[model samples]
Structures are given as C-alpha cells and as structure tokens.
Target: MSELGIHYRRGPATVTGSPRPRQGPHAGDRLPDTPAGLQRRVAGPGYHLLFGGPTRSWPQDPPLGGRGDLVSVHHLGTQSPWPGITHALVRPDGYVGYLARGTDLTGLRAYLDRWLPAR
Candidate 1:
C-alpha cells in the first residue's frame, strides 16, 4: 500500500499481533484466469481453486455445506500467479486464503479448516 502511495496509520500505535500480510492474492485482486476460464471454474457460488504443477487430483472437499459452496477446482499451468505454488484456495471475496508450493493436502486442509468456522 505504501508503495502505491496509499498510507494508513503507521508505527507501534497501529494494532499489533495480527498475522503477517500474505502476498498470494488480496481481497479485491482479480483471479489469474481468463474470463471464459474463470467462468467455467467459478460457475457456482464458492471459491475459485487453482493448482499449479502436474497434479490433476485435488483433495476431497472439506466439511463445507456443498461442493458448490466449498470450491470450484481448476488446474493452473504456467500462467499461475504464484509459479511455485501447487495449490491455492481463493475465497469468494477474492482473497487467497491458502497457498501451497508443494503437494500438502493435509496442511491445506488444516488451513482451510481454521477459517471455515469463522466464515
């Protein structure tokens, strides 16, 4: 934000102890997908999942309400926003909640589980 000339309250007086800001994707950032591709991926109401690398498989949907409300998985190729990441869970709000550089479904599950209850 600072680099973009958007400034906010700075220094120790600002609220502290929050988790470090992640760089994968911001709340309002665009999904790194073509219009048609994104249309196909997020055809329903849910997350727009993207995975890099040669993996065609995705983890089983977690305990969310329905597949449509959980995630719409897609295979991201070389055009991936985060080149090294194997998987990323883009929330409906457009923020990337989780990203994995390797095939770690368990870790991804844990990360998503931590946020599901809050949602």
Candidate 2:
C-alpha cells in the first residue's frame, strides 16, 4: 500500500471471538454471555482476516473514508503482494476507485453519486 505499506496487508479479513476469555463459567464460548463482557470483548480488535477464497467480511473494519463510508473491500496483504489480485481504492474525500469484476460494489456507486466531484 502507498500509505500503510506491505506490513498492514493482512489479507481478506473475517470477524471472530476474542482470543482471551475473562474466565468464569461462561468462558470459551461466544465472546461473552453477559452484556458487559460482550462490550469489553468488542472494545478490543476482534476480527480474523482471510485472503482470497469466496467473498468474506473484513477481520477489522472495512477500508473507511474520512466521511465514514466503507471505501474498498480489497487491500494489500501477504496473499496480495506485487499488485496482485482484484483490488479497489477509496478516498476519505470521496474519490472513485476501480472495482474488479465479480464484486458487488453498489455501495461505492452510491457514494460516488453523493460524494465524488461531479456528484
């Protein structure tokens, strides 16, 4: 990536329960049985990233724009080195990006209509 560089390239990501459980009776199961525990669990980074395969969710947050809309689904990762694979770039200021074939980028189109220069 031009900004974060290859280090941030973790690959297509997914979300999952946290690694550590607070212990107690309800540990080892879904994040937390109690509302408070759930809060704490989500308070921290809790997503598993996956690279190439079928469509999946981002482990962390999806690439975000300055105004708060998901910008792109593809990002640089170990599995996506050398500008390889399908990719897209979103701008915080609302810039149009290239969308690879097979991806449903309806959200991007909506954003462009509302934010991009002409829109």
Candidate 3:
C-alpha cells in the first residue's frame, strides 16, 4: 500500500485523502533512496509540483532551496494561501508536507532563474 497521506493542516478545504493512485512516483519507486537523492529530485530543474486550480497532479517534483532567486519556503518557515503556490518535492505526504513552511516550485521558475537542467 502507499505510505502517502494528505496532510491535514488547520484550514478550510482541508486535504481529504491520499491522491487517487496515478502514474509517475509510485509507492515503491525508490527514486529518493537517500538524502542526497531526495535533495536532487526535490530541487531538480525542469520540475515543479503545483497544487490547486484545474491541474491536479504535478508531472515533476519541485525545485530545492535557494537564497536570492529561488526562495525556499521550507527555509522561510511560513505558509502562504494557495492559488498558484508550489513547493519543493519533499515527498508528497512526508512530515514536511504538513509543515507550515517549504519551497514553491512554480514561484521558483516564474521568478527565480533556476531551470531544470538534465542531469
């Protein structure tokens, strides 16, 4: 079974259940076999996980942390209301998923200069 779960934060339109089983990152994909691997996938370029609006699932993981261009939401330790908000790929339902702060990939690409370069 999938180890993922929707994080229930204190807010309206709360995340209900695990995202209906889809393609890509499955339960046992094993992409993030280690911390560094996770780091790469989360912050890798050409990828941004967006939530809300018509689009449901993100085709790719979000970007990682940054100082000037890419603002690391996780690093900031805060939360912003969603509409076009995205975040770093730190596991869909991991502990950080429930955290108040993290990265937003859509914002990163739109504002930041970071781009997903093939690795």
In terms of lDDT, the best-performing candidate is 1
Taken over the whole model, the C-alpha lDDT of each candidate is: 0.51, 0.28, 0.30
- Alpha-carbon error at 8 in model 1, in Å? 13
Q: What's the alpha carbon RMSD for model 3? A: 13.3
User: Per lDDT, what order, best first?
Assistant: 1, 3, 2
**Residue 34 displacement in candidate 3 (angstroms):** 18
Candidate 3 similarity to native, TM-score: 0.19
Tell me the alpha-carbon RMSD of every candidate. 7.2, 16.7, 13.3
> Residue 85 CA error for candidate 1 (Å)?
4.6
Candidate ranking under TM-score, highest first, comes to: 1, 2, 3
After TM-score superposition, what is the CA distance of residue 12 in candidate 1 from its true location, in Å? 19
TM-score of 2: 0.21
Q: Is candidate 1 or candidate 2 better by lDDT?
A: 1
The TM-scores, one per candidate, come to 0.54, 0.21, 0.19
Find the candidate with the highest TM-score and give its number: 1
